[model samples]
Target: MQMLMYQECIDACFDCMVACNSCYDACLKEDDVKMMADCIRTDRECADICALAIKAMQSNSPFAKQICALCAEICEACGEECQKHSHHDHCRRCAEACFRCAEVCRRMAA
Candidate 1:
């Protein structure tokens, strides 16, 4: 059960990473790129953190729970930031992905 849960969390993290990367790239292409600078930076950070959390969980590190808790927080913040640009489909999709990943991370942390 524990292994399966960890695998699912890892998968969620990877999915969130992909979504964040795509959203960041799309944001850069927008005409108002400067307005989205913060979003882009946060997306990149969230993706990196998610990846790190997944690696820690996969390795059964003692810090996995703490990492997952932090990941959840980052995911939620990223989601909220992305939601600010809901007019952009990429941002909307990214927000949804972040929310899903946050839920998974929360469960893993619990």
Candidate 2:
């Protein structure tokens, strides 16, 4: 059961990474990219953190739980930031993905 939970968490991390990357790329294409600067930065940070959390979990490290907890927080913040621009379809989708990933990470952390 623990192993299965780890796998699910890893999957969620990957999904969040993809979503973050996509959102970042889309943001760069916007006419006013400066407006999304913070969102872009958060997306990159969240993606990196999620990937690190997945690696830690896969290694069965004792710190994995703590890393996952941090990852969940970052993911939630990123999601909220992304949701601010619901006018963009990509941002909306990315926010949803981040929210889902955060929930999964929270469960795994616990």
Candidate 3:
């Protein structure tokens, strides 16, 4: 029963990780990659944190809630950064994914 609840959060985290990776790659391909430095860095951190959050939840770690809390923070920050470059479809998608992940993480953490 509890596993089912965490499953949803795990799925969201996985999806967000994928979206962040894609967005980071797309940003690097842009004509002005340097302009997306912050986005790139944040996206990478968000993706890594999402993966860690998923793992922590899956293992039922004692610190799972803490990991989810940190994940939510990074996800929100990444979402904001991506939203700033919403002109890019990849960035928009990443932002949406990050927002979704953050919501799920927060719910699970609480």
Candidate 4:
């Protein structure tokens, strides 16, 4: 696939990656780190996948579509986890970015 065609998805993935990283850092600093365990884990995982997806798309990898599908799934899961802690600004922003990334990834995968 042409990189141009995947620009939107790439941008979304980048945004999600940043949001997830920020959320992960913020969660670790929260008073109740134990309570933020799931969110922290999900954020890390989501950020990793988003980074991978960006690389795959940038390289025009043959598995780009498949990678995107998995990225979407992980993004959705991360979004749900972040949404649970949405009262926190970082979590809320992360959730929004994850959901947007998931949508963009789904379209790219299709």
Instruction: State each candidate's clash count.
Output: 0, 0, 0, 0
Candidate 3 lDDT, 1-110, residue by residue in tens: 66787999999999999999999999999999999999999999999999999889888899999999999999999999999999999999999999999999999889
lDDT: worst 10-residue window of model 4: 1-10
lDDT of 1 by residue, 1-110 (tens): 56676998899999999999999999999999999998898899899999999889878889999999999999999999999998999999999999999999999999
Steric clash pairs (candidate 4):
none
TM-score of each prediction? 0.95, 0.95, 0.97, 0.98
On the 0 to 100 scale, the lDDT of residue 54 in model 1 is 83
TM value for model 4: 0.98
Clashes of 4: 0
For model 4, residues 24-109, the per-residue Cα lDDT tens digits are: 99999999999999999999999999999999999999999999999999999999999999999999999999999999999999
Q: Candidate 3, after superposition: displacement of residue 47 in Å?
A: 0.3
Off by over 4 Å in 3: none
Best by lDDT: 4
Worst 10 residues of 2 by lDDT: 1-10
lDDT (Cα, tens digit) per residue for candidate 2, span 9-51: 8998999999999999999999999999989999999999988
RMSD per candidate (Å) reads 1.1, 1.1, 0.8, 0.9
Candidates 1 and 2 compared by lDDT, better number: 1
